[model samples]
Target chain A: MKILVFVKQVPDTDDVKLDPKTGNLRRDGVKSMMNPMDANAIEAALQLREKHGGSVCVVTMGLPMATEVQKKALGMGCDEAYLLSDRPFGGADTLATSYTLAKAAEKIGGYDLLLFGRLATDGDTAQTGPAVAAQLGIPQISLASSIAVEDGWVYCDRDLGDTVQRVRAKLPAVVTVNGGINKPRYATPINIMRAQKKPRTTWTAADLGCDMTKIGTPGSPSSTKKVFEPEKRNTDTQYLTGSPEDMARALADLLENEHLL
Target chain B: MKSDYQGIWVFAEQENGKLHPTVLELLAKSKELQKHNGEKITAVLLGADVSALADTLFSYGADAVLLCENEALRSYSARPYQKALTQLSEKYRPSIILYGATPLGRDLAPRVMVSLDTGLTADAIDLGFDEDGVFYQTTPGYGGKILAHIVILERRPQMATVHAQICSPIEPIADASGELIVEKLNIEPDGDYEVLETRSAEKSGESLAEAKVVVAGGRGVKTEEDLAMLRELADLLGGQLASSRPLVDNGMLPHDRQIGQSGATVSPDLMLNIAISGSVQYQLGMQKAKCIVAINQSEDAPIYDIAHIGAVTDYKKLVPALIAKIKARKQ
Candidate 1:
């Protein structure tokens, strides 16, 4: 079996700093890591490969630096890595991104299964995976908290609000794994060392057979018109001190006067 | 790329034959949208025995209701809901469709959009429209790093899912008038998907989403012992306990207990923040809290700027005192 996992490099959310003037994420000098959810996707694929005796291919489309993410995935036990990086792929929204990924997945070929994180940390749209599946015209099982593969079929326990459902779909289907799907294993020293030597196949838009006009920024229908910090609430600071009883009385008094009690 | 789609439809989400809170909220918001755009709030209720709620929907703001009740639609297993919703959208050709952004909506809405080959904006925080019937939808993105403006042009029934608690429901207009249109889909239920059984987890006090008072903890709480005090204060005040991502990452709390972009967005009436320094990620979640109360030793804590009430004292000291105060007031 050949399983494909899609991943992306996102600015380490903790270290992400907005330029005070521009109110946009400061990308330069900001550290990037594979999206945490995508890491779970890679781990899920790696685990399946371990069980099913298959090769796991990690694929991504981003800037050249995103190749580092592919290396990281390879270190984590993926067999092959590919980076479909090109200037044309920049500024793609979920639709364009999914379309580009679909084309790239076709280019890589020979995939029994497609796995994706429920959503990317950077975008959080959760649209790309299902969109890709739709564009590929394949059955998709999303929000899969747990999955089992047997006899060329994927059976999944999907998390639906306060309920779980058992879902079954044939192979060559796309599955988006939620975070609870599995605990990602840490890469050992040997794996990390071997990963450094793994070659990352680089593909441009042309290699993926993507139309330049419909591959990236221009292809995306929705755009971020503007980015601004949410308005901070203007409030007066009132402090209450003393014993719990006293503080409680004061709070109750405040609440009563404010008509909230 | 403009497509001809007409009417405004709300998916009247129901479970066990009762409407969900989000359905009412959507109807209320849609009522506002209807008045502004000269459109009507049409609701699509899909499930077994769902027509019973059509009267309630009309009271809440539905101008006309589409009832698709079937035994197969009983439990909401995505495939059937997607099929039903897609069929309704195709038949009515609603210019806009609103969903609650609940787990079911999040799962089913996108699939319907995909099946219909249309565009959908998920987890919309707010919705507005222009005179030309173009819907302007807003949603938090990049883990709440930014609010992205989404417009589904060239697609019929510009779809959006509104996050719960962001919008308040209006009291149904007394004796308000609307038409109740019951339409059933002709498709048979595919038993390929089955709900073997359903069980609901017991929810804790005041779901953070609906809680009027919320107390959130962070890494500054130091240890599990500190969380005891935070929990005590939350209990005394009749609120739910929330936390920053760091605490959840550290295994101090579950993901459901985290309050941030990734977890649950809250708009509590009163938010009691303990030992949490405000990051934009955290702030974006609780920014809508009516009155924010912060207890942190740092006078320079970012939380203080957004808090309506704050104490520049150790949370260790503050938590105990607050708990005691509540206890005494009760006595």
Candidate 2:
């Protein structure tokens, strides 16, 4: 079993504070961390490799700094890591990003399984994995809670909010796993030292034979016309000034007046 | 005229022969957009033996319902459904396509976008035509602090998955009529993936969106044991228990109970912010709730800025008293 896992580096959402006046996030000096769900993906791939006896390789598409996440994955027991970084790959949307990743999948051939996180925290659009499956003309199962492989087929139990859909797909299919699928393991000091010796590769869009028109902003069909803060909801909050008991009673009366009681 | 692509289409998603509620909502929204573009509104439906849904779609103001029924689409495996939708779009060449940003929609729409080589904006909150007559999609991102208006720079059949409940479904007219175009797609059931079983959660697992009232806890909830107080209040109000994203991340609550940009966007009637400071992302998710009450120790918490009512005190002491008061009021 050969597994290719895609991961991403994102802003530490916990540290992302809002600018009260501008209504923009105070992104300056905010640190970056591995996307939580993608760490779960790496753990899933590592566990699969443990049982099936093959190599787990991690890949990401971002600026050169994204190598941080690749290094983390390597330290987590991946045999090797690949980063897709290029000047042209900048400003690519899900469509262009998926195309470039698909090209990477072609260049690094013969993967029996392709894994992705349910979504990237930054975009929160779980579109790339499925789009890549479509571009490659392969099957895809998304939001899997558990995955099992047997007899050249993969079975995944997907958690779709109120329902669970148990599905099975053949080998070489794309599967995007949700968070809480498994707890990711931390890298040990010895493994961290050894991971520095592991093979790491960086490929540009041209190196992947990407269509210059389809690999970056030029290939992206969607363009951001404007980015601005959403208007705050129009409501003047009335503070309840009283003792705890009185405040509770007043709130109850308010609810009653609103026909909520 | 933009390569002759014409009209607007909404994907009427269905499960177990029942049309998803979001489809009607999208139809209502498309009707509003139709006024600006002066184009017909079409509801594109793909399911097995779902032809009866066409009347309902029309009643909700769809100018037409493109009904494509096939057994291969019965289970909604991405392999067949994406192909079927892509074929219909290629054949009809609609100017814009809309879908509810549902799990299935998120799964299906992007594949079709790839097949047709188009753009798709996910979870758009608003749609409109600019002065130049160009359509744009407004979606919140970057932790829900910013809204980006996006346009398909050069693509026919622009696509997007809209957030649910952003607009209410228009009133249905019993005698409203529209054109019904019936077609059968030619596609075999995908042999690659097969659905084995499907099961819904127990009734106790109430969805936050459907609840009339939501009692949400955040970092101020203290410990996991403190959740019982909020759950008690929710039960008293005949509602569901919800949590800020941090609670779920802390394993204090399940992911489905999380209410935020990364989780489920809820618009309940009354939502109590128990110790939640309300990040921009959290506010964006629950801002649509009819009434909001922010309760926390700090008076400067941002949650109070939008809440209808606020109390600057510890929720630990306030929640129990409020629950008792509500119970007394009901009596």
Query: In order, what fnat does every candidate score?
Result: 0.34, 0.73
Determine the backbone clash count of candidate 2: 0
lDDT (10s digit) by residue, model 2, range A1-261: 999998988887533445767655678997788888888888889999888989998989998888878888999999989999999998888899889989998888899889998887778789998998888889999888888888888899887767788999998899998876787899777787789999999999878999999978998999988677556565798899888888898889888888888
lDDT of each: 0.75, 0.85
- Candidate 1 lDDT over A142-256, as tens digits, reads 8777787888778887765345667777777888987767778777778877987776799888888887767676776555545665555566777666654455466666655
Candidate 1 CAPRI classification by DockQ: acceptable
Winning candidate number (lDDT): 2
Residue B196 shift from truth in candidate 2, angstroms: 0.4
* Candidate 1 structure quality by residue, lDDT tens digits, B1-331: 2445667899888888888888999988887887887777788888886676888888888888888877778877666777788787777788888888776777677667667756677777778874565578887654454565677665566777777756677887887667877776776665444444445523444567888888899768768789888887777777788898656544466556778644678898888888787765577689889888787776766677788877777767656765665566567
Q: How accurately is candidate 1 docked according to DockQ?
A: 0.33
i-RMS for every candidate: 5.2, 3.6
State how far residue A100 of model 1 sits from its true place (Å).
2.3
